[model samples]
Target: MNPGDRASWNQTANADFVLVGLFGETKPATFLYMVTFIFFLLALAGNTLLIVLIRVQPRLRTPMDFFISQLSLMYLMYISMTVPKMLVGQVTGDRAISASCCGVQMFFSLNLNGEKCFLLAAMASNPYTAICRHLHYTLLMSQRVCECLLSGCWLLGMSDGFLLTPIIMSVPFSQSRKIPSFFCETPALLKLSCADISLYRTFMYVCCVLMLLIPIVVILSSYASILRLIHRMNSAEGQRKAFATCSFQLILGLFFFGAAVYTYMLPTSYHTAEKDIMIPAFYTIITPVLNPLIYNFRNKDFTGALRSTMQLGLSPRKAGNGRA
Candidate 1:
Protein backbone atom coordinates (compact mmCIF):
# COMPACT_ATOMS: atom_id res chain seq x y z
CA MET A 1 0.00 0.00 0.00
CA ASN A 2 3.03 2.30 0.20
CA PRO A 3 2.72 4.77 -2.67
CA GLY A 4 6.37 4.86 -3.69
CA ASP A 5 6.90 1.21 -4.51
CA ARG A 6 6.33 1.08 -8.26
CA ALA A 7 6.40 -2.68 -8.68
CA SER A 8 3.89 -3.41 -5.94
CA TRP A 9 2.04 -0.19 -6.83
CA ASN A 10 1.47 -1.44 -10.36
CA GLN A 11 -0.52 -4.35 -8.92
CA THR A 12 -3.29 -2.02 -7.68
CA ALA A 13 -5.60 0.34 -9.48
CA ASN A 14 -5.15 3.04 -6.84
CA ALA A 15 -1.51 3.69 -7.70
CA ASP A 16 -1.97 4.80 -11.30
CA PHE A 17 -4.71 6.72 -13.13
CA VAL A 18 -5.70 6.55 -16.76
CA LEU A 19 -7.35 9.42 -18.57
CA VAL A 20 -9.96 8.63 -21.21
CA GLY A 21 -9.63 11.66 -23.37
CA LEU A 22 -12.25 13.22 -25.70
CA PHE A 23 -11.99 10.88 -28.66
CA GLY A 24 -13.60 7.56 -27.75
CA GLU A 25 -14.61 6.54 -31.24
CA THR A 26 -13.25 4.94 -34.39
CA LYS A 27 -11.60 8.20 -35.43
CA PRO A 28 -7.81 8.39 -35.40
CA ALA A 29 -6.14 9.81 -32.30
CA THR A 30 -4.70 12.40 -34.66
CA PHE A 31 -8.18 13.78 -35.21
CA LEU A 32 -8.51 14.72 -31.54
CA TYR A 33 -4.88 15.76 -31.53
CA MET A 34 -5.37 18.16 -34.43
CA VAL A 35 -8.56 19.55 -32.96
CA THR A 36 -7.00 20.10 -29.51
CA PHE A 37 -3.83 21.50 -31.05
CA ILE A 38 -5.84 24.16 -32.92
CA PHE A 39 -7.81 25.17 -29.84
CA PHE A 40 -4.69 25.19 -27.67
CA LEU A 41 -2.98 27.48 -30.18
CA LEU A 42 -6.04 29.72 -30.34
CA ALA A 43 -6.41 29.90 -26.57
CA LEU A 44 -2.73 30.65 -26.12
CA ALA A 45 -2.61 33.24 -28.91
CA GLY A 46 -5.84 34.98 -27.98
CA ASN A 47 -5.20 35.34 -24.26
CA THR A 48 -1.52 36.19 -24.66
CA LEU A 49 -2.29 39.04 -27.08
CA LEU A 50 -5.03 40.39 -24.86
CA ILE A 51 -2.74 40.45 -21.85
CA VAL A 52 0.10 42.07 -23.82
CA LEU A 53 -2.20 44.68 -25.30
CA ILE A 54 -3.59 45.52 -21.91
CA ARG A 55 -0.10 45.71 -20.47
CA VAL A 56 1.69 47.56 -23.27
CA GLN A 57 -1.07 49.67 -24.75
CA PRO A 58 -1.90 52.61 -22.53
CA ARG A 59 -5.30 52.78 -24.18
CA LEU A 60 -6.20 49.50 -22.43
CA ARG A 61 -5.14 50.74 -19.00
CA THR A 62 -8.58 51.13 -17.50
CA PRO A 63 -10.55 49.69 -14.59
CA MET A 64 -12.20 46.98 -16.74
CA ASP A 65 -9.06 45.96 -18.57
CA PHE A 66 -7.18 45.57 -15.30
CA PHE A 67 -9.59 42.89 -14.21
CA ILE A 68 -9.57 41.56 -17.78
CA SER A 69 -5.81 41.26 -17.60
CA GLN A 70 -6.24 39.14 -14.49
CA LEU A 71 -8.91 37.10 -16.24
CA SER A 72 -6.61 36.49 -19.17
CA LEU A 73 -3.92 35.36 -16.80
CA MET A 74 -6.35 32.93 -15.18
CA TYR A 75 -7.40 31.66 -18.59
CA LEU A 76 -3.79 30.95 -19.35
CA MET A 77 -3.35 29.02 -16.08
CA TYR A 78 -6.68 27.29 -16.55
CA ILE A 79 -5.76 25.99 -19.96
CA SER A 80 -2.26 25.08 -18.82
CA MET A 81 -3.66 22.79 -16.13
CA THR A 82 -5.04 20.41 -18.73
CA VAL A 83 -3.89 21.05 -22.29
CA PRO A 84 -0.18 20.16 -22.16
CA LYS A 85 -0.86 16.81 -20.54
CA MET A 86 -3.44 16.21 -23.24
CA LEU A 87 -0.93 16.95 -25.96
CA VAL A 88 1.45 14.49 -24.30
CA GLY A 89 -1.30 11.89 -24.40
CA GLN A 90 -1.74 12.53 -28.08
CA VAL A 91 1.94 12.00 -28.79
CA THR A 92 2.83 9.05 -26.54
CA GLY A 93 -0.52 7.25 -26.71
CA ASP A 94 0.15 6.76 -23.02
CA ARG A 95 -2.76 7.87 -20.94
CA ALA A 96 -1.15 6.72 -17.71
CA ILE A 97 -0.62 9.30 -15.00
CA SER A 98 0.65 8.71 -11.50
CA ALA A 99 -2.00 8.94 -8.80
CA SER A 100 -0.11 11.76 -7.12
CA CYS A 101 0.08 13.66 -10.41
CA CYS A 102 -3.63 13.16 -10.89
CA GLY A 103 -4.13 14.72 -7.47
CA VAL A 104 -1.96 17.67 -8.46
CA GLN A 105 -3.85 18.19 -11.71
CA MET A 106 -7.23 18.04 -10.01
CA PHE A 107 -6.17 20.48 -7.31
CA PHE A 108 -4.88 23.12 -9.76
CA SER A 109 -7.79 22.74 -12.17
CA LEU A 110 -10.26 23.25 -9.33
CA ASN A 111 -8.21 26.10 -7.94
CA LEU A 112 -8.10 27.96 -11.27
CA ASN A 113 -11.77 27.30 -11.90
CA GLY A 114 -12.54 28.91 -8.56
CA GLU A 115 -10.26 31.83 -9.40
CA LYS A 116 -12.05 32.31 -12.72
CA CYS A 117 -15.46 32.47 -11.05
CA PHE A 118 -14.28 35.12 -8.61
CA LEU A 119 -12.70 37.11 -11.46
CA LEU A 120 -16.01 37.09 -13.33
CA ALA A 121 -17.80 38.45 -10.27
CA ALA A 122 -15.14 41.11 -9.79
CA MET A 123 -15.46 42.01 -13.47
CA ALA A 124 -19.22 42.39 -13.09
CA SER A 125 -18.58 44.99 -10.40
CA ASN A 126 -16.42 46.95 -12.83
CA PRO A 127 -19.27 47.57 -15.29
CA TYR A 128 -21.73 48.26 -12.49
CA THR A 129 -19.45 51.04 -11.31
CA ALA A 130 -18.93 52.31 -14.86
CA ILE A 131 -22.51 52.77 -16.06
CA CYS A 132 -24.21 53.04 -12.67
CA ARG A 133 -21.73 55.39 -11.01
CA HIS A 134 -19.89 57.04 -13.86
CA LEU A 135 -18.45 59.91 -11.83
CA HIS A 136 -17.25 57.63 -9.02
CA TYR A 137 -16.09 54.70 -11.17
CA THR A 138 -12.45 55.76 -11.33
CA LEU A 139 -12.27 56.80 -7.69
CA LEU A 140 -14.02 53.61 -6.56
CA MET A 141 -11.90 51.17 -8.53
CA SER A 142 -8.57 52.63 -7.43
CA GLN A 143 -5.27 50.79 -7.59
CA ARG A 144 -5.56 49.79 -3.93
CA VAL A 145 -9.10 48.50 -4.41
CA CYS A 146 -8.13 46.60 -7.54
CA GLU A 147 -5.27 44.98 -5.70
CA CYS A 148 -7.57 44.10 -2.83
CA LEU A 149 -10.10 42.52 -5.18
CA LEU A 150 -7.44 40.54 -6.97
CA SER A 151 -5.92 39.38 -3.68
CA GLY A 152 -9.30 38.35 -2.29
CA CYS A 153 -10.06 36.39 -5.47
CA TRP A 154 -6.81 34.44 -5.19
CA LEU A 155 -7.36 33.76 -1.50
CA LEU A 156 -10.96 32.66 -1.85
CA GLY A 157 -10.12 30.40 -4.78
CA MET A 158 -7.12 28.89 -3.02
CA SER A 159 -9.23 28.21 0.05
CA ASP A 160 -11.79 26.34 -2.03
CA GLY A 161 -9.11 24.16 -3.54
CA PHE A 162 -7.33 23.78 -0.22
CA LEU A 163 -10.48 22.66 1.53
CA LEU A 164 -11.76 20.40 -1.21
CA THR A 165 -8.49 18.80 -2.26
CA PRO A 166 -7.79 17.06 1.02
CA ILE A 167 -11.36 15.84 1.49
CA ILE A 168 -11.48 14.37 -2.02
CA MET A 169 -7.99 12.99 -1.79
CA SER A 170 -8.87 11.14 1.38
CA VAL A 171 -11.44 9.10 -0.51
CA PRO A 172 -10.35 5.56 -1.35
CA PHE A 173 -10.18 5.00 -5.07
CA SER A 174 -9.65 1.25 -4.77
CA GLN A 175 -12.27 0.24 -7.30
CA SER A 176 -10.77 1.88 -10.36
CA ARG A 177 -8.09 4.27 -11.47
CA LYS A 178 -9.44 4.96 -14.92
CA ILE A 179 -11.19 8.35 -15.11
CA PRO A 180 -13.61 8.56 -18.01
CA SER A 181 -13.36 12.31 -18.28
CA PHE A 182 -10.58 14.22 -20.04
CA PHE A 183 -9.42 15.96 -16.85
CA CYS A 184 -9.43 15.13 -13.17
CA GLU A 185 -12.72 16.71 -12.12
CA THR A 186 -14.24 16.17 -8.69
CA PRO A 187 -17.20 14.19 -9.97
CA ALA A 188 -15.17 12.02 -12.28
CA LEU A 189 -12.52 11.32 -9.65
CA LEU A 190 -15.18 10.54 -7.07
CA LYS A 191 -16.58 7.91 -9.36
CA LEU A 192 -13.29 6.08 -9.10
CA SER A 193 -13.51 5.69 -5.33
CA CYS A 194 -14.56 2.40 -3.81
CA ALA A 195 -16.34 3.61 -0.71
CA ASP A 196 -19.76 5.20 -0.43
CA ILE A 197 -19.29 8.75 -1.63
CA SER A 198 -22.87 9.88 -1.34
CA LEU A 199 -21.96 12.26 1.46
CA TYR A 200 -18.97 13.47 -0.51
CA ARG A 201 -21.25 14.08 -3.46
CA THR A 202 -23.57 16.13 -1.31
CA PHE A 203 -20.62 18.06 0.09
CA MET A 204 -19.24 18.82 -3.37
CA TYR A 205 -22.67 19.84 -4.66
CA VAL A 206 -22.98 22.29 -1.80
CA CYS A 207 -19.52 23.69 -2.48
CA CYS A 208 -20.29 23.97 -6.18
CA VAL A 209 -23.55 25.82 -5.50
CA LEU A 210 -22.02 28.27 -3.04
CA MET A 211 -18.92 29.01 -5.11
CA LEU A 212 -20.63 29.03 -8.50
CA LEU A 213 -24.12 30.36 -7.79
CA ILE A 214 -23.28 33.30 -5.53
CA PRO A 215 -20.79 34.78 -7.98
CA ILE A 216 -23.18 34.29 -10.88
CA VAL A 217 -26.02 35.86 -8.91
CA VAL A 218 -23.83 38.87 -8.15
CA ILE A 219 -22.90 39.11 -11.84
CA LEU A 220 -26.54 38.99 -12.90
CA SER A 221 -27.66 41.60 -10.40
CA SER A 222 -24.84 43.91 -11.45
CA TYR A 223 -25.77 43.53 -15.11
CA ALA A 224 -29.44 44.20 -14.39
CA SER A 225 -28.48 47.42 -12.62
CA ILE A 226 -26.17 48.26 -15.52
CA LEU A 227 -29.02 47.67 -17.97
CA ARG A 228 -31.34 49.93 -15.97
CA LEU A 229 -28.69 52.66 -15.82
CA ILE A 230 -27.98 52.27 -19.52
CA HIS A 231 -31.72 52.45 -20.29
CA ARG A 232 -32.07 55.69 -18.34
CA MET A 233 -29.18 57.30 -20.17
CA ASN A 234 -30.12 59.90 -22.79
CA SER A 235 -26.97 59.48 -24.91
CA ALA A 236 -27.38 56.65 -27.42
CA GLU A 237 -23.65 56.41 -28.03
CA GLY A 238 -22.86 56.07 -24.36
CA GLN A 239 -25.63 53.52 -23.91
CA ARG A 240 -24.39 51.43 -26.81
CA LYS A 241 -20.83 51.65 -25.56
CA ALA A 242 -21.81 50.56 -22.06
CA PHE A 243 -23.74 47.57 -23.36
CA ALA A 244 -20.96 46.59 -25.73
CA THR A 245 -18.36 46.49 -22.98
CA CYS A 246 -20.22 44.13 -20.67
CA SER A 247 -22.13 41.97 -23.18
CA PHE A 248 -19.35 39.56 -24.12
CA GLN A 249 -18.23 39.10 -20.53
CA LEU A 250 -21.81 38.49 -19.46
CA ILE A 251 -22.20 35.90 -22.20
CA LEU A 252 -18.97 34.20 -21.14
CA GLY A 253 -19.91 34.07 -17.46
CA LEU A 254 -23.33 32.63 -18.16
CA PHE A 255 -22.14 29.89 -20.51
CA PHE A 256 -19.22 28.73 -18.33
CA PHE A 257 -21.17 28.87 -15.08
CA GLY A 258 -24.29 27.29 -16.56
CA ALA A 259 -22.39 24.38 -18.01
CA ALA A 260 -20.35 24.00 -14.81
CA VAL A 261 -23.42 23.97 -12.61
CA TYR A 262 -25.10 21.39 -14.79
CA THR A 263 -22.04 19.17 -14.68
CA TYR A 264 -21.12 19.44 -10.98
CA MET A 265 -24.30 20.46 -9.16
CA LEU A 266 -26.45 17.52 -10.19
CA PRO A 267 -26.58 14.38 -8.07
CA THR A 268 -24.60 11.37 -9.25
CA SER A 269 -27.83 9.42 -9.69
CA TYR A 270 -28.79 11.70 -12.53
CA HIS A 271 -25.87 11.28 -14.93
CA THR A 272 -23.19 8.84 -16.02
CA ALA A 273 -19.47 9.02 -16.86
CA GLU A 274 -20.33 8.54 -20.52
CA LYS A 275 -22.21 11.84 -20.45
CA ASP A 276 -19.61 13.67 -18.35
CA ILE A 277 -16.52 13.57 -20.61
CA MET A 278 -18.25 15.62 -23.28
CA ILE A 279 -19.21 18.50 -20.99
CA PRO A 280 -15.92 19.75 -19.47
CA ALA A 281 -14.11 20.04 -22.82
CA PHE A 282 -16.52 22.68 -24.05
CA TYR A 283 -16.07 24.90 -21.01
CA THR A 284 -12.37 24.16 -20.52
CA ILE A 285 -11.24 24.48 -24.15
CA ILE A 286 -13.86 26.44 -26.05
CA THR A 287 -14.72 29.04 -23.41
CA PRO A 288 -11.12 30.11 -22.78
CA VAL A 289 -10.52 30.67 -26.51
CA LEU A 290 -13.75 32.61 -26.81
CA ASN A 291 -12.80 35.14 -24.11
CA PRO A 292 -10.17 36.92 -26.19
CA LEU A 293 -12.00 36.34 -29.46
CA ILE A 294 -15.12 38.00 -28.07
CA TYR A 295 -13.17 40.97 -26.80
CA ASN A 296 -10.97 41.44 -29.86
CA PHE A 297 -13.87 40.97 -32.22
CA ARG A 298 -16.46 43.09 -30.43
CA ASN A 299 -14.78 45.63 -28.15
CA LYS A 300 -13.68 48.63 -30.16
CA ASP A 301 -10.95 49.57 -27.73
CA PHE A 302 -9.49 46.11 -27.96
CA THR A 303 -9.84 45.87 -31.72
CA GLY A 304 -8.42 49.34 -32.16
CA ALA A 305 -5.41 48.45 -30.08
CA LEU A 306 -5.10 45.12 -31.85
CA ARG A 307 -5.23 46.84 -35.24
CA SER A 308 -2.64 49.39 -34.18
CA THR A 309 -0.35 46.70 -32.81
CA MET A 310 -0.65 44.78 -36.08
CA GLN A 311 -0.03 47.96 -38.06
CA LEU A 312 3.19 48.60 -36.21
CA GLY A 313 4.08 44.93 -36.30
CA LEU A 314 4.06 45.03 -32.49
CA SER A 315 6.47 47.87 -31.79
CA PRO A 316 6.38 47.84 -27.98
CA ARG A 317 7.50 51.43 -27.47
CA LYS A 318 5.01 52.89 -29.95
CA ALA A 319 2.09 50.70 -28.85
CA GLY A 320 2.70 51.55 -25.21
CA ASN A 321 2.39 55.22 -26.14
CA GLY A 322 -1.35 54.56 -26.66
CA ARG A 323 -1.00 55.53 -30.33
CA ALA A 324 0.79 52.97 -32.39
Candidate 2:
Protein backbone atom coordinates (compact mmCIF):
# COMPACT_ATOMS: atom_id res chain seq x y z
CA MET A 1 0.00 0.00 0.00
CA ASN A 2 3.01 2.31 0.44
CA PRO A 3 4.27 2.53 -3.14
CA GLY A 4 4.15 6.22 -4.00
CA ASP A 5 4.09 5.86 -7.83
CA ARG A 6 0.75 6.59 -9.53
CA ALA A 7 1.33 3.67 -11.92
CA SER A 8 0.40 1.21 -9.18
CA TRP A 9 -3.23 2.37 -8.87
CA ASN A 10 -5.45 -0.53 -9.92
CA GLN A 11 -9.21 -0.95 -9.72
CA THR A 12 -10.64 -3.87 -7.76
CA ALA A 13 -13.96 -5.75 -7.88
CA ASN A 14 -16.95 -4.44 -5.91
CA ALA A 15 -17.48 -7.15 -3.35
CA ASP A 16 -19.96 -6.75 -0.48
CA PHE A 17 -18.32 -7.37 2.84
CA VAL A 18 -20.69 -8.47 5.60
CA LEU A 19 -20.20 -6.42 8.74
CA VAL A 20 -20.29 -8.52 11.88
CA GLY A 21 -21.61 -7.58 15.29
CA LEU A 22 -19.21 -6.11 17.86
CA PHE A 23 -19.05 -8.58 20.70
CA GLY A 24 -18.40 -12.22 19.59
CA GLU A 25 -21.89 -13.59 19.03
CA THR A 26 -25.08 -12.52 17.25
CA LYS A 27 -27.13 -12.96 20.42
CA PRO A 28 -24.89 -10.57 22.35
CA ALA A 29 -25.08 -8.03 19.55
CA THR A 30 -28.87 -7.80 19.96
CA PHE A 31 -28.49 -7.43 23.69
CA LEU A 32 -25.82 -4.76 23.25
CA TYR A 33 -27.94 -2.84 20.75
CA MET A 34 -30.75 -2.58 23.28
CA VAL A 35 -28.34 -1.60 26.05
CA THR A 36 -26.59 0.98 23.88
CA PHE A 37 -29.93 2.45 22.78
CA ILE A 38 -30.95 2.91 26.39
CA PHE A 39 -27.59 4.51 27.14
CA PHE A 40 -28.01 6.86 24.18
CA LEU A 41 -31.36 8.02 25.53
CA LEU A 42 -30.05 8.53 29.04
CA ALA A 43 -27.02 10.42 27.73
CA LEU A 44 -29.18 12.71 25.61
CA ALA A 45 -31.75 13.37 28.32
CA GLY A 46 -29.20 14.00 31.09
CA ASN A 47 -27.05 16.32 29.03
CA THR A 48 -30.07 18.19 27.69
CA LEU A 49 -31.45 18.70 31.19
CA LEU A 50 -28.03 19.90 32.32
CA ILE A 51 -28.05 22.54 29.59
CA VAL A 52 -31.62 23.59 30.40
CA LEU A 53 -30.85 23.88 34.08
CA ILE A 54 -27.74 25.89 33.39
CA ARG A 55 -29.48 28.30 31.02
CA VAL A 56 -32.78 28.68 32.96
CA GLN A 57 -31.10 29.45 36.27
CA PRO A 58 -29.26 32.75 36.62
CA ARG A 59 -27.15 31.78 39.60
CA LEU A 60 -25.42 29.09 37.51
CA ARG A 61 -23.81 31.78 35.31
CA THR A 62 -20.23 31.48 36.46
CA PRO A 63 -17.26 30.97 34.12
CA MET A 64 -16.85 27.28 35.01
CA ASP A 65 -20.51 26.42 34.60
CA PHE A 66 -20.58 28.29 31.30
CA PHE A 67 -17.82 26.05 29.92
CA ILE A 68 -19.49 22.98 31.41
CA SER A 69 -22.74 23.85 29.66
CA GLN A 70 -20.83 24.09 26.40
CA LEU A 71 -19.22 20.76 27.13
CA SER A 72 -22.61 19.14 27.61
CA LEU A 73 -23.85 20.60 24.33
CA MET A 74 -20.78 19.41 22.46
CA TYR A 75 -21.05 15.90 23.92
CA LEU A 76 -24.67 15.74 22.87
CA MET A 77 -23.80 16.78 19.34
CA TYR A 78 -20.95 14.33 19.11
CA ILE A 79 -22.94 11.36 20.32
CA SER A 80 -25.90 12.25 18.12
CA MET A 81 -23.73 12.19 15.02
CA THR A 82 -22.32 8.69 15.64
CA VAL A 83 -24.82 6.65 17.64
CA PRO A 84 -27.79 6.65 15.24
CA LYS A 85 -25.73 5.42 12.31
CA MET A 86 -24.44 2.64 14.50
CA LEU A 87 -27.97 1.60 15.49
CA VAL A 88 -29.25 1.72 11.92
CA GLY A 89 -26.28 -0.22 10.61
CA GLN A 90 -26.76 -2.89 13.23
CA VAL A 91 -30.55 -3.19 12.95
CA THR A 92 -31.05 -2.84 9.21
CA GLY A 93 -27.82 -4.66 8.31
CA ASP A 94 -26.86 -1.97 5.82
CA ARG A 95 -23.13 -1.77 6.45
CA ALA A 96 -21.77 0.00 3.38
CA ILE A 97 -22.02 3.76 2.81
CA SER A 98 -21.30 5.97 -0.19
CA ALA A 99 -17.95 7.73 -0.43
CA SER A 100 -19.54 11.05 0.48
CA CYS A 101 -21.24 9.51 3.48
CA CYS A 102 -17.98 8.03 4.71
CA GLY A 103 -16.32 11.39 4.22
CA VAL A 104 -18.95 13.11 6.35
CA GLN A 105 -18.50 10.55 9.10
CA MET A 106 -14.74 10.99 9.09
CA PHE A 107 -15.13 14.77 9.31
CA PHE A 108 -17.53 14.67 12.27
CA SER A 109 -15.52 12.04 14.15
CA LEU A 110 -12.35 14.07 13.88
CA ASN A 111 -14.03 17.39 14.53
CA LEU A 112 -15.90 16.25 17.65
CA ASN A 113 -12.85 14.37 18.92
CA GLY A 114 -10.53 17.36 18.59
CA GLU A 115 -12.99 19.80 20.08
CA LYS A 116 -13.73 17.50 23.01
CA CYS A 117 -10.02 17.17 23.72
CA PHE A 118 -9.64 20.93 23.67
CA LEU A 119 -12.70 21.35 25.88
CA LEU A 120 -11.37 18.92 28.46
CA ALA A 121 -8.11 20.84 28.58
CA ALA A 122 -10.08 24.05 29.22
CA MET A 123 -12.14 22.23 31.85
CA ALA A 124 -9.02 21.12 33.68
CA SER A 125 -7.58 24.63 33.51
CA ASN A 126 -10.78 26.06 35.00
CA PRO A 127 -10.26 24.34 38.33
CA TYR A 128 -6.52 24.91 38.29
CA THR A 129 -7.07 28.66 38.31
CA ALA A 130 -9.82 28.55 40.94
CA ILE A 131 -7.77 26.39 43.28
CA CYS A 132 -4.24 27.70 42.77
CA ARG A 133 -4.97 31.37 42.23
CA HIS A 134 -8.33 32.19 43.77
CA LEU A 135 -7.80 35.96 43.87
CA HIS A 136 -6.82 36.21 40.17
CA TYR A 137 -9.27 33.54 38.85
CA THR A 138 -11.78 36.29 38.09
CA LEU A 139 -9.22 38.25 36.08
CA LEU A 140 -7.79 35.14 34.47
CA MET A 141 -11.01 33.40 33.38
CA SER A 142 -13.41 36.20 32.53
CA GLN A 143 -16.30 35.97 30.07
CA ARG A 144 -14.19 37.35 27.23
CA VAL A 145 -11.41 34.90 28.04
CA CYS A 146 -13.86 32.01 28.10
CA GLU A 147 -15.30 32.99 24.73
CA CYS A 148 -11.84 33.30 23.16
CA LEU A 149 -10.70 29.95 24.53
CA LEU A 150 -13.83 28.17 23.27
CA SER A 151 -13.54 29.85 19.85
CA GLY A 152 -9.95 28.73 19.60
CA CYS A 153 -10.98 25.18 20.48
CA TRP A 154 -13.55 25.04 17.67
CA LEU A 155 -11.12 26.57 15.14
CA LEU A 156 -8.34 24.15 16.03
CA GLY A 157 -10.73 21.20 15.79
CA MET A 158 -12.01 22.33 12.40
CA SER A 159 -8.44 22.80 11.19
CA ASP A 160 -7.68 19.15 11.96
CA GLY A 161 -10.72 17.94 9.99
CA PHE A 162 -9.93 20.29 7.07
CA LEU A 163 -6.41 18.95 6.85
CA LEU A 164 -7.85 15.44 6.46
CA THR A 165 -10.24 16.40 3.65
CA PRO A 166 -7.72 16.69 0.80
CA ILE A 167 -5.91 13.48 1.69
CA ILE A 168 -9.18 11.57 1.96
CA MET A 169 -10.31 12.96 -1.41
CA SER A 170 -7.26 11.71 -3.27
CA VAL A 171 -7.64 8.12 -2.08
CA PRO A 172 -9.14 5.94 -4.79
CA PHE A 173 -12.00 4.00 -3.31
CA SER A 174 -12.12 0.61 -4.99
CA GLN A 175 -15.48 -0.78 -6.11
CA SER A 176 -15.55 -2.52 -2.77
CA ARG A 177 -16.03 0.44 -0.44
CA LYS A 178 -17.45 -1.22 2.65
CA ILE A 179 -15.82 -0.23 5.94
CA PRO A 180 -15.79 -2.93 8.62
CA SER A 181 -16.22 -0.60 11.56
CA PHE A 182 -19.68 0.51 12.75
CA PHE A 183 -18.81 4.13 11.98
CA CYS A 184 -16.28 5.41 9.47
CA GLU A 185 -12.89 5.76 11.11
CA THR A 186 -9.95 7.22 9.17
CA PRO A 187 -7.85 4.07 9.40
CA ALA A 188 -10.68 1.92 8.09
CA LEU A 189 -11.21 4.40 5.24
CA LEU A 190 -7.50 4.37 4.50
CA LYS A 191 -7.62 0.60 4.08
CA LEU A 192 -10.20 0.91 1.27
CA SER A 193 -8.04 3.29 -0.77
CA CYS A 194 -6.50 1.99 -4.02
CA ALA A 195 -4.05 4.89 -3.98
CA ASP A 196 -0.91 4.80 -1.86
CA ILE A 197 -1.86 5.58 1.76
CA SER A 198 1.60 6.07 3.31
CA LEU A 199 1.22 9.82 3.34
CA TYR A 200 -2.28 9.65 4.78
CA ARG A 201 -1.14 7.21 7.43
CA THR A 202 1.74 9.48 8.36
CA PHE A 203 -0.51 12.52 8.47
CA MET A 204 -3.13 10.76 10.63
CA TYR A 205 -0.54 9.47 13.04
CA VAL A 206 0.90 12.94 13.59
CA CYS A 207 -2.49 14.56 13.98
CA CYS A 208 -3.72 11.89 16.38
CA VAL A 209 -0.66 12.28 18.56
CA LEU A 210 -0.93 16.04 18.60
CA MET A 211 -4.70 16.37 18.93
CA LEU A 212 -5.14 13.43 21.32
CA LEU A 213 -1.95 12.63 23.18
CA ILE A 214 -0.79 16.16 23.91
CA PRO A 215 -4.14 17.12 25.38
CA ILE A 216 -4.14 14.04 27.56
CA VAL A 217 -0.69 14.98 28.81
CA VAL A 218 -1.73 18.57 29.46
CA ILE A 219 -4.85 17.48 31.34
CA LEU A 220 -2.93 15.02 33.48
CA SER A 221 -0.25 17.60 34.24
CA SER A 222 -2.84 20.22 35.17
CA TYR A 223 -4.65 17.82 37.48
CA ALA A 224 -1.41 16.71 39.12
CA SER A 225 -0.61 20.27 40.00
CA ILE A 226 -4.13 20.73 41.30
CA LEU A 227 -3.83 17.68 43.54
CA ARG A 228 -0.52 18.88 44.90
CA LEU A 229 -1.89 22.34 45.58
CA ILE A 230 -4.96 20.90 47.21
CA HIS A 231 -2.85 18.74 49.52
CA ARG A 232 -0.89 21.81 50.65
CA MET A 233 -3.93 23.70 51.92
CA ASN A 234 -3.48 24.86 55.52
CA SER A 235 -6.85 23.79 56.89
CA ALA A 236 -8.42 20.32 56.71
CA GLU A 237 -11.79 21.81 55.75
CA GLY A 238 -10.26 23.74 52.81
CA GLN A 239 -8.42 20.62 51.67
CA ARG A 240 -11.59 18.54 51.78
CA LYS A 241 -13.46 21.17 49.78
CA ALA A 242 -10.74 21.33 47.11
CA PHE A 243 -10.54 17.54 46.85
CA ALA A 244 -14.26 17.32 46.27
CA THR A 245 -14.03 19.83 43.41
CA CYS A 246 -11.15 18.02 41.70
CA SER A 247 -12.31 14.39 42.13
CA PHE A 248 -15.16 14.39 39.61
CA GLN A 249 -12.97 15.77 36.83
CA LEU A 250 -10.24 13.28 37.59
CA ILE A 251 -12.61 10.29 37.38
CA LEU A 252 -14.33 11.46 34.19
CA GLY A 253 -11.04 12.44 32.58
CA LEU A 254 -9.55 9.05 33.33
CA PHE A 255 -12.54 7.24 31.81
CA PHE A 256 -12.52 9.41 28.66
CA PHE A 257 -8.77 9.20 28.12
CA GLY A 258 -8.54 5.51 29.02
CA ALA A 259 -11.21 4.38 26.56
CA ALA A 260 -9.93 6.68 23.81
CA VAL A 261 -6.31 5.63 24.02
CA TYR A 262 -7.35 2.00 24.21
CA THR A 263 -9.41 2.34 21.07
CA TYR A 264 -7.09 4.39 18.86
CA MET A 265 -3.52 3.81 20.00
CA LEU A 266 -3.39 0.07 19.51
CA PRO A 267 -1.67 -1.61 16.52
CA THR A 268 -3.58 -2.03 13.26
CA SER A 269 -3.32 -5.82 13.53
CA TYR A 270 -5.20 -5.69 16.83
CA HIS A 271 -8.08 -3.72 15.28
CA THR A 272 -10.79 -6.08 14.21
CA ALA A 273 -13.81 -3.82 13.51
CA GLU A 274 -15.72 -5.53 16.29
CA LYS A 275 -13.61 -3.81 18.96
CA ASP A 276 -14.23 -0.28 17.70
CA ILE A 277 -17.90 0.06 18.66
CA MET A 278 -17.62 -0.95 22.29
CA ILE A 279 -14.86 1.49 23.25
CA PRO A 280 -16.55 4.49 21.63
CA ALA A 281 -19.78 3.76 23.53
CA PHE A 282 -17.94 4.41 26.79
CA TYR A 283 -16.74 7.91 26.00
CA THR A 284 -19.75 8.94 23.95
CA ILE A 285 -22.68 7.40 25.83
CA ILE A 286 -21.44 6.67 29.34
CA THR A 287 -19.43 9.85 29.86
CA PRO A 288 -22.12 12.32 28.87
CA VAL A 289 -24.79 10.56 30.93
CA LEU A 290 -22.54 10.42 33.97
CA ASN A 291 -20.94 13.88 33.72
CA PRO A 292 -23.85 16.11 34.78
CA LEU A 293 -25.10 13.82 37.52
CA ILE A 294 -21.63 13.24 38.93
CA TYR A 295 -20.55 16.86 38.78
CA ASN A 296 -23.77 18.49 40.03
CA PHE A 297 -24.96 15.97 42.60
CA ARG A 298 -21.55 15.96 44.26
CA ASN A 299 -21.35 19.74 44.57
CA LYS A 300 -23.09 21.57 47.41
CA ASP A 301 -23.86 24.77 45.50
CA PHE A 302 -25.40 23.06 42.48
CA THR A 303 -27.38 20.70 44.70
CA GLY A 304 -28.88 23.70 46.47
CA ALA A 305 -29.52 25.34 43.10
CA LEU A 306 -31.32 22.22 41.89
CA ARG A 307 -33.37 22.15 45.06
CA SER A 308 -34.26 25.82 44.56
CA THR A 309 -35.28 25.17 40.95
CA MET A 310 -37.59 22.38 42.10
CA GLN A 311 -39.09 24.52 44.86
CA LEU A 312 -39.64 27.50 42.60
CA GLY A 313 -41.75 25.43 40.24
CA LEU A 314 -43.80 23.79 43.00
CA SER A 315 -44.80 26.79 45.18
CA PRO A 316 -48.57 26.92 45.70
CA ARG A 317 -50.65 29.87 44.45
CA LYS A 318 -52.31 32.16 47.05
CA ALA A 319 -56.03 31.55 47.77
CA GLY A 320 -58.68 34.23 47.15
CA ASN A 321 -60.01 34.03 50.73
CA GLY A 322 -58.87 37.01 52.87
CA ARG A 323 -58.87 35.22 56.28
CA ALA A 324 -59.49 31.48 56.00
lDDT of 1: 0.82
Error (Å) of candidate 1 at residue 78 is 1.5
Top candidate on lDDT is 1
All models: lDDT?
0.82, 0.75
Clashing pairs in 2: none
Candidate 1, residue 79: lDDT: 86
- Quote model 1's TM-score: 0.88
What's the C-alpha lDDT at position 4 in model 2? 44
lDDT of 1 at 279: 75
Model 1 residue runs over 4 Å out of place are 1-14, 310-324
Provide the TM-score for each candidate, comma-separated.
Answer: 0.88, 0.85
